[model samples]
Target chain A: MDLAPPIRFELRRGAVTAIPLAIAVGLFGVSFGVLSASTGGMGALPAIVMSATTFAGSAQFAAASVLAGGGGPVTAILAALLLNARYLPIGVSVARFMLGGRVARFVQSQLVVDESWAIASRGGGEFDPHRLVGAGVVLWCAWVAGTVIGVLGGEALGDPAALGLDAAFPALFLALLVPQLGGRRARAAAALGAGIAVVLVPFTPAGVPIIAAAGAAVIGLVRR
Target chain B: MSESWAIVLAVGAGTMAIKAAGPVLLGSRPLPAQVQRVVALLAPALLAALVATAALASGQQLVIDARLLGLAAAAVALALRAPVLLVGAIAAAAAAVARLAGLG
Candidate 1:
């Protein structure tokens, strides 16, 4: 369907799609910032830094959980790394776009996540790099803003877990997941990657599973 | 603020490395078409992996508890294509209620 829809269509769809997902991601991130702040011993600064760079909610949450629970830096880092290893494949998968500008490519990979990638891909073929960048920019701003909100919101709640606000994070992931299951390969690959990731949790470090599963899947993908 | 410098550096460095690692690692050769195809699914796989670990595990053991209850509730919400905000709230509420009820 090379129907080159007006760039306007791509722009509109990209913005619309990116906004809600960004908000969802922002809600999750804000909860994380608040949770990190709630630890009493940690600073809001550290949490924000984690969110800005890591930008990975689950691993960041896991890292914060471990850190707050008195885990060592090594433990926290390992947890975060293992959990975030998924990004490696995400980076590789999207690397094709990074070809033109090495620097931009690097930056792009860093920010790619469930929200941005999904939104960008949906822009259809009409969705050019510009729209993708626009979507990412929107999501990034929203996430950071939401983090502040979540930080303040968490404090006001005093215990976000009390109101079950914590669940919003996972719920956000759920919303992103349905739209992503676009094909059999994707669904099967995801199932395999996740199953491997879950089973390997106890043995592997936090970030290793996604990388491992992606590695495993790559072999299959390449073989076929 | 001083501590934030190191944290900021770390964040910046981390992003720089992960972003750079791809091209540096892959060089010029395109990934096999199959692998490129599979790469598309990494998001969901990662999502499921994270979701399961978060909701289904307690410490080192697998336990069916409030978290699981919440996740299950959220799954229903997802199936129904409920809005994200409502889904998250209901899931968490379900988990909290289950915890309160001792049924988890």
Candidate 2:
């Protein structure tokens, strides 16, 4: 592995690599903010705080949806937590890259998410610690900034669904999933997961199907 | 605090704990080979599941709607190797246009 680049250089590279996805992330954040704000009980401030603190788009959106559907706070939190359980494996993958002391590791762990994890682990077996930190910083800022914009303009934005922003969530995931479909095994695992989730959709709660689908990864353990 | 705020705070704390678990517990030790392989596959598998659930299901019901058009547009854009941002834009536009046409 090459010597770690200077923090500034890594930060710049991370920001640049993340810029395109950040726009989509920003849009998602804006939609989440608008949805949370419009969901009756949640106000703009709570929405902003949730985005700032949680920093997990899908989890937050799931929680908000639960709340909107008349679920209690405990139920909403549980749903969000279940949705976020993916971060455990993600954190394990990025743990080696989280350099420095225990405090630094703890603080940096907060940046673990789908995009940052994907970017940092893009090198396959080797991990880029700088990219991890840099991407986390840029993506975090975009998420929070987008939420602020959404909260302020949420009413004006009026119905993110009508704008097709709701579809953008799956669209973004699809875009990310495309590049990973390179190998036959990966494609099979993905197909199995999707098939299971689709089959369970009508019977499951919002986030449960995804967790259940994680079982499909067990196929990776099987020899061809 | 208000109920919403409390929920946010609780969720936030729970999330931070979940995020912290791997780094704190695993430290520098490598995962077992089989575990690592499965972990590697988790992202693609979970992401595929998320895409299916998000695109095909609304709440608890499965329904095909404008989102399908949007997903198709995204697929076409991705196949053409458009920039990631452009893919999203194309999908959104396709879905919005479809909705306007009462296809949603």
Candidate 3:
């Protein structure tokens, strides 16, 4: 079905606003592509296919790293799923805004990523679904395109970490976090979450630290 | 299918299910007031955790490496109110320079 003019305008504006972040994410996609193709036991086709289908960066990287370390399929899949556990809460947060039939809602849900979600957020628990969908589309395209380039380039891409693309994830996350640090409760949660993650990093599995940190948000339950 | 294909398809399927679970299950239900408050704080908490893990840890170990330089540079850029893209670029450049200087 066709989008209404107002929604279409919002979508376009979202796409435009997301372009810069998309470029950064695309470069990170290139790193994933190279890693999967080179040592993750996934060839060019499967790597690209995974990127297109899964559309989750940290989870994909975790799975590929597991495989690269000679872990089995079950291990890789589990690691990826654990890394993605955050999506459950993320989905809940935005569910009401996701209007449409089941099929459309599912399709829109596919577009939700950390970057797009952050971009779509209006403080105080609000969101713009059109912006989320729009940004997701652009970022998805860039991710897949970057994967194609990386997998095809393969060995020639050398060490992606050397290019500092790995740094982009943290950088991007920091930028996203700063904007949301507006209130005392938010700041407290942020500090608690970061502390939990930092302390757990040395003791937990790949995805555990991040997941454990989400518990810090339970502080929101206390009256300010 | 090859093991790689199997893993890829399985992970894809699993992640799709995970992503869809919320919108599918909740389906426009009105969340409780407390739940809404928690949801509002979720993004900041998650993003902060992401920053900590992505910048400071590699695997199960905390590695104080060049990624820290990148993150610090990003902090400075963000403080100066740089756009997100420039913040990322500044970060990558800082990490790359650190690596070139034999830091990581």
Q: Of the candidates shown, which would achieve the greatest TM-score relative to the real structure?
A: 3
Candidate 1: pairs in clash: A81-A207, A82-A206, A82-A207, A82-A208, A83-A206, A83-A207
Indicate the DockQ of the complex predicted as candidate 2: 0.73
Task: Report the C-alpha lDDT of model 1 over B1-104, residue by residue, as the tens digit.
Answer: 35434444554566557655865566555777666555655666666665666665555555666676777788898898787667777887887787667666
What is residue B76's positional error in candidate 2, in angstroms? 1.5
DockQ of each: 0.44, 0.73, 0.83
Q: lDDT by residue for model 3 over B13-99, one digit each (tens)?
A: 989999999998889997999999999999999999999999999899999998999999999999999998999889989999999
Best DockQ among the predictions, by candidate number = 3
Model 3's lDDT to the true fold?
Answer: 0.90
Q: Quick one: best lDDT, which candidate?
A: 3
Model 2: pairs clashing at backbone N, Cα or C within 3 Å: none
**Candidate 3: which pairs clash?**
none
**Interface RMSD of candidate number 2:** 1.6
Docking class of 1: acceptable
Candidate 2 residue runs with Cα over 4 Å from true position:
A1-10, A123-126
DockQ comparison, 2 vs 3, better candidate? 3
**lDDT pick, better of 2 and 3:** 3
